[model samples]
Target: MRTSRTELLLGRTLLVVALVLTVLPLLSMLSAALQPADRNPTGLSWPSDPQWINFVTAFQVGHVWQLMGSSALIVLGVVPASLLFATLAGYALGGLRVRGGRAVLVFLVLGLTIPFEALIIPLYYQAQAMGTLNTQWAIVFPLIGLFMPFSVFWMRAHFVNVPVELSEAARVDGASIWQEFRRIQLPLATPALSALAILLFLWTWNQFLLPVVLVANPLDRTVAGALTFFQGQYYSSIPLLNAGALIIITPAIVVFLIFQRQFIKALLQGAVKG
Candidate 1:
């Protein structure tokens, strides 16, 4: 009983520490966002009068709505494409009896090792050849390609955790391979898929380098790129920048909160079964 009580106390202390560590930076950013613009030297302190208008100002001055629309278009295009391609590839690798499946998997795993920076110059040239530069397709296509390898890896791991006997049973019932995967395997992969969708959404939303390099027009820029607008050669607007940062970060936070359980489940799935 005494040992159990000590363990409980230790858990609570650790939770408190974790919460503080996670929240402190967010609190500082919020404070900075609210700080008066006319202050002598902007420091991280609670505002005497919180300027809730910073958010509004951020929207007006930054052309935030346009940036958001650009980001949304990229996310909408990339997430579904990545998920569908990854799911089909993962199902094939995990469940099918095709020859050279292991080789394909090894190639995909190798893809994860190659840095995106190395591919950017080549990708830019390809985009230019395709007449996609400064267009939404330029950013969207590369993000889809970059995200696919990891998505396949993640979904394949989850698919492997699903029991082989389930597929066998589906086959015994006269289901075709496609039908079995659609009806049995994909249904069982919901938790992992949900987790992957949220992750991909976050990643695509936060992508800066691709958009910066591929897109030149501010009208085509994403929220990640829009943050750079607040930084100038001679002057910087820290508070407004923090406001933009908050706007960019809030959606991801909301998504993680919504799918928190699914994310945890995906992490825990294979540990017990495999």
Candidate 2:
């Protein structure tokens, strides 16, 4: 059915309203970050003289470069590892019928329900006992496990929708399971995996609690985790704090901007089946 003029106008108006709601706060924060670090600016108004050096001041005082390095290392470790494991597990559960597969899927569903807050204390003690406390591994290891539920679910959703004929064709050609996965299914699953990687990278980069509890040094913390300590020290400095916040989130924004097309494609890929 063709949409009426009134419906189109209403939809556009709603979208514009939603866009303004989302962009306004970001503009306000960027505005605030341009003010002098020592001066406290209130509300969302343009600064008389933008202090570009506020970013430099925040970068220096917050050790943002070091925190960024730490976050990069963590993202490198977490995203690839999580993607690899989740892909294999998703293939097993979604593409193949294995013994006890239902039970395993149920367990993962349960894992998703368990709140991170409830597990933090136990994870802390476990890290302490394993002597991994205060190390980057402390953060990297738990993140992989915590990410498994959602990652597996995402890949499995893609895998389940894949036609069985593709797998059968590979098998008829005398291809082993690994060979089939490597040569056939994986190529078709690229969009889904790319989307998953983007989500995993953002989650790992923004992880705050694990680094805070498990890692002791501010330098060792992820950028978002380090933000807590930075805030405590510079609570009085609004400009620097806002600048630091922007620096920490910039990577995630950039990644989404770059991969947004793939991300949208992945979401829409499964929307229709022939």
Candidate 2 Cα lDDT to native: 0.90
Tens digit per residue, CA lDDT, model 1, 1-274: 2579889999999999999999988888889888754443345578778988888877677777888898999999999999999999888887674688889889988999999899999999999999999999999998988998899989888877788889889888999988888888888899889999999999998888988899989768677877776656313666777777888888889989989999998888877764
lDDT of candidates 1 onward, in order: 0.84, 0.90
Clashing residue pairs, candidate 1? none
Worst 10-residue lDDT window for candidate 2 reads: 225-234
Q: Per-residue CA lDDT of candidate 2, range 1-274, in tens?
A: 7999999999999999999998898899899999987889999999989998988878788887889999999999999999999999999988885688889889999999999999899999988998899999999999999999999988888889999999999999999999999998899899999999999999999998889889989899899964565566688988888888888888899999999999999999978788
Q: How much is 42 displaced in model 1, in angstroms?
A: 6.0
What TM-score, computed on C-alpha atoms, does each candidate reach?
Answer: 0.92, 0.94
Cα deviation in Å at residue 256, candidate 2? 0.7
lDDT of 2 at 198: 95
Candidate achieving the largest lDDT: 2
lDDT of 1 at 122: 95
